[model samples]
Target: MEFLDEIKAKFPNVLESVDGSNENESVLLLKDKTKIKRVCKEVKNHFDILFMLMAVDKPPKIFELNYVFSSYKTQNILTIRVNIERDKAVIDSISSLFESADWEERETYDLFGVEFIGHKNLKRILLPEDWPGRPLRKDFEVTDEVRNWTGLDLKF
Candidate 1:
């Protein structure tokens, strides 16, 4: 928990809460999206890798982003969670700090439409560039446009 303590001591203003109930995993909820890059930079040395970057689309307003970091030395995981408005789905990119974050952030953006600023190649990873809307979003509707794009409208 030394790493957690250091983060708390350093960035108390950005952190909203800490959940240290788990033995090997700790969850840190950040209050501001803009400060994510700064926090990641400060804590880069503690973790060995950025294991995963995922998002939960809690409709009508929020998108909860979870950044999982793993350390081989300690066999521990630290998750940083940040909640951002669904309408304004943007966050600072940590791809510069973590190499794995490059593809993970791209996939997140391709599916959920999260704009990761500072990513050198922040483009679609799994879908075509012209794909209509972020299909993973809760409000995404399967319309005729999508059907046509997928050739689902062709009659046999």
Candidate 2:
């Protein structure tokens, strides 16, 4: 709790809010996506491990990216959240700070179409390069070509 308060005091402009609930997991919402790398670097000073990075498509045009981190010394879990506009879903890449982020960012880009602006090799990791559209988007439709390929009579 004190750590979050300290972070809030230190980076008031970048940090939006701190969630105390959910078993004391500190969820930090970042107001500026451009400062994500710097903020994550600051967080790395306290949180040693990057547990996971993923993206979620909030319907009606919003994409939320979440980065989960944990501190081995204090056993604290911290989650950083950034909201991106669906039309221009671009955010700074943290792969440089955390090597594990390379694949995660690529996967998020592949499925959610959330581009990590500074990623070295930003490309599809799971789906093919020729994949029609981001499969994870709320409006993504299952085409007949895909259904026929998989031999499933998909209705939608």
Candidate 3:
């Protein structure tokens, strides 16, 4: 698809680096988390759907967010990854561009403690609002409160 070449030509400032060597999918690393919305808006036409939004807690400093996009017509997958500071794990929400990103973003927020700055309704989806901490984070500690909340405190 020459996707990287097109992106470089059209939106030179959006990507920091790209790995287009894979035939099945292309991976792009954004230079800044704040530019995510801009990039999504530009590429929304090429990718019909935001297939998934996932987060990875890289201990000691970073939280990587992967925004996977798919095109039904072209059967192509493109992933845009952005890394934010672990302590300040916040990023612009792409829900405005893709409907599917709404729930996916909320799920990531619920589990990873990421703040989707412009999400219309950013709230806990899977876990309750009163939940102790973000369970998916690498630094999360399993305390009695958390264990009891999940009924993990029950003895077998």
After TM-score superposition, the amount by which residue 155's alpha carbon in candidate 3 deviates from its true location, in angstroms, is 20
Q: How many clashes in each structure?
A: 0, 0, 0
Q: What's each prediction's TM-score?
A: 0.90, 0.88, 0.89
lDDT of 3 at 69: 92
Q: Which candidate, 1 or 3, would have the higher lDDT against the true structure?
A: 1
* lDDT of each residue in 17-66, candidate 1, tens digit only: 56554757888899988899988987787888999998999998999999
**Best model per TM-score:** 1
Clashing pairs in 3: none
C-alpha lDDT (0 to 100) for residue 48 of candidate 3: 94
Name the candidate that leads on lDDT: 1
Q: What is the lDDT of residue 1 in candidate 3?
A: 63
Question: Model 1, stretches more than 4 Å misplaced?
Answer: 151-156
- Give the total clashing residue pairs for model 2: 0
Worst 10 residues of 3 by lDDT: 15-24
Error of 3 at 124 (Å): 0.4
TM-score of model 1 vs. true structure: 0.90
Candidates sorted by TM-score, best first: 1, 3, 2
Model 2, position 60, has a per-residue lDDT of: 82
